[model samples]
Target: MTHSLEEHGTEREGPLSLQEIDEIIGTENPPLRNLRITYAYHQLAVALARLLDDRNATWCGFGTWASRTAGLFIRGELKPRPVGLPPVPPWVSRHLMTWAAPHVGSNVARGNLLVFQELGPLFHTMVTAYTEEDDAERALERVLQPLRPGLVTEGGQDLLIAAARSYHRAMPLPHSAARSQVILLANLQVALHEQIRLQEAIAASLAPPLRAPFTPAPLNVLATRFWGRLATSHLMDVYMPAVDFTTTRTLIPLRLGRDVGGAHGATTFCEHLTDLIDLELKALLYDFDRSPNSVLGSAAADWSLLAERMNYLTDFFRLWQQDPCLMQAPFTPRQAEDLRAGKMPSGPPL
Candidate 1:
């Protein structure tokens, strides 16, 4: 039977008053602190998205976020719910949300997915300062901290924001593309880890590989709980088409391509970076659909890696969807050819 948060009960619209949002999803959930934090970020995201000129795009992000929240509180599906979120620009938020819509599920992974979207992929960035073990998550805390609101901010060691007095300036905020790129890439990294965890759980549960670790038994029918949260960052190709690492003469530490050669330069090299996404997804599907060699063929695994891979792929595409930079690719192949042979940005003809 199909279930939906919107259909489950009589839903209420806000002015929910802070207490209401808090009470419905309150500490009754595990990872309670994080869920409260996610809801808080969603509130901030809603307010911020309203400020953008492109309201539809902004609304997209907010809607996905709210739906995810409702899903968590209602708790029907199997995926984990998100706890807290970092600030994400409305446009990027829209793209990521759209890309991920198909992958959304209830329960555990959903929550984890949202947090992964809000926070970028530096899953292992050491959280300390000055080599003091006692510092505890300080370095990580700083990175996770939202950007300061101002013209110019420092990221240390020659990294400067160059200030934006207005949004119309040549460069867009890193918060949009940068955040999406980091988050998507980070999710990829963690998927492998989560896969391992699932593997462990599967091994312990039964020797037969064909069975799904989770089935009809619903969780949060189990929350009374809440929980949580990288960066190769391929999304730069999607967001920043004109200004690139090679063009700007900067060494960006991203792992978007395979072997950094051939046609797969960055995700944005093609329209929508669809090729890169398709490739990754195909590989994932192969794993999910194909079975590993076994001496005793004890029923191949069911739930396919496709489920989780699609989840990450959805997030990746969402970031690409909302990028204003992606709205215009600087030059087409013919234009590049003409320019290489000496031509203007307009070139000879279409």
Candidate 2:
């Protein structure tokens, strides 16, 4: 029997809070009706990340929670797949296909290449210290000394900024469908760069000598898991959906909700997206389970928090389908001006 949300769990309480809604649509002309749902999934991602860090869980525990959370997410129910839809344009199909296909392989390979090209000597230094019976702490410090800030600088933060400039170039809105492709791609580029910053921060937080057993092995393991999680969760849950939403929205106008063909076409466009995302999640979980960090033990009580977060994210997806504007809210005038001027608003102090 197909499970309904009410039957299995509580009714959908969406991700965004009332205050956030106010921020999205200011007081002057409040949305005729408040959104029943909020952007809960993004919140969940942030919360889960905080838990991982604040708890300072072991590498194994971190790996396990990530894998399981992704697993439950993969197995969760999505909106019913649409049937009898007309075909999308070849360009749209091809673009969606690229988004669905696995990209982690090339990305991970590039990461390894960077390690060898830039960090090879650093690793060599550590190995030599081990062989020479030198102090592991001192060796690790020497290796990490030059790498932290260098990782942030050479690693594409600047490239991301340069790429955002392309987004500011005015494009014809009449061709919004096609233009959206460029816009979404540029945004994903920036998001990926942000992911790089996250990965770097994770690496930097490790005090080589202080953490002790100063070896590259555990660090390498952590790096692999970190990249895997980012690629799977971010690409699957956020990027692909954003692309699908844009493509479908551009091709099939939201006002055509009552038009059978238009609705079906939109549904078809999003139909396989979740499945594609789940495929990647499964692959990620499998890789994590096979890694040395996967331990044989009971899951922490915090696992429930992960489950709850996944539900929030899932519900957010449903809420977003009902109203895409929630996730793709229009940029305010000041925000647009800032973007055009190539000035990023500063994030809150860390």
What RMSD does each model have against the real structure?
21.3, 23.0
Q: For candidate 2, lDDT tens digit of each residue in 241-293?
A: 22233224222222111211212333222321222322323332333222111
Given candidate 1, what's the lDDT at residue 144?
38
Identify the candidate with maximal lDDT.
1
Backbone-clash count (model 1): 27
lDDT of each: 0.28, 0.28
For residues 16-90, write the lDDT of model 1, one tens digit per residue: 133433343334443333333333333332332323222112222222333333333333222221211235444
Model 2 per-residue lDDT at 98: 39
Candidate 2 wrongly placed segments (more than 4 Å): 1-152, 155-157, 202-325, 328-350
Residue 104 miss distance in model 2 (angstroms):
22
Evaluated at residue 125, the lDDT of candidate 1 is 18
My TM-score estimates for the predictions, one after another, are 0.26, 0.25
Write down the TM-score for model 2. 0.25
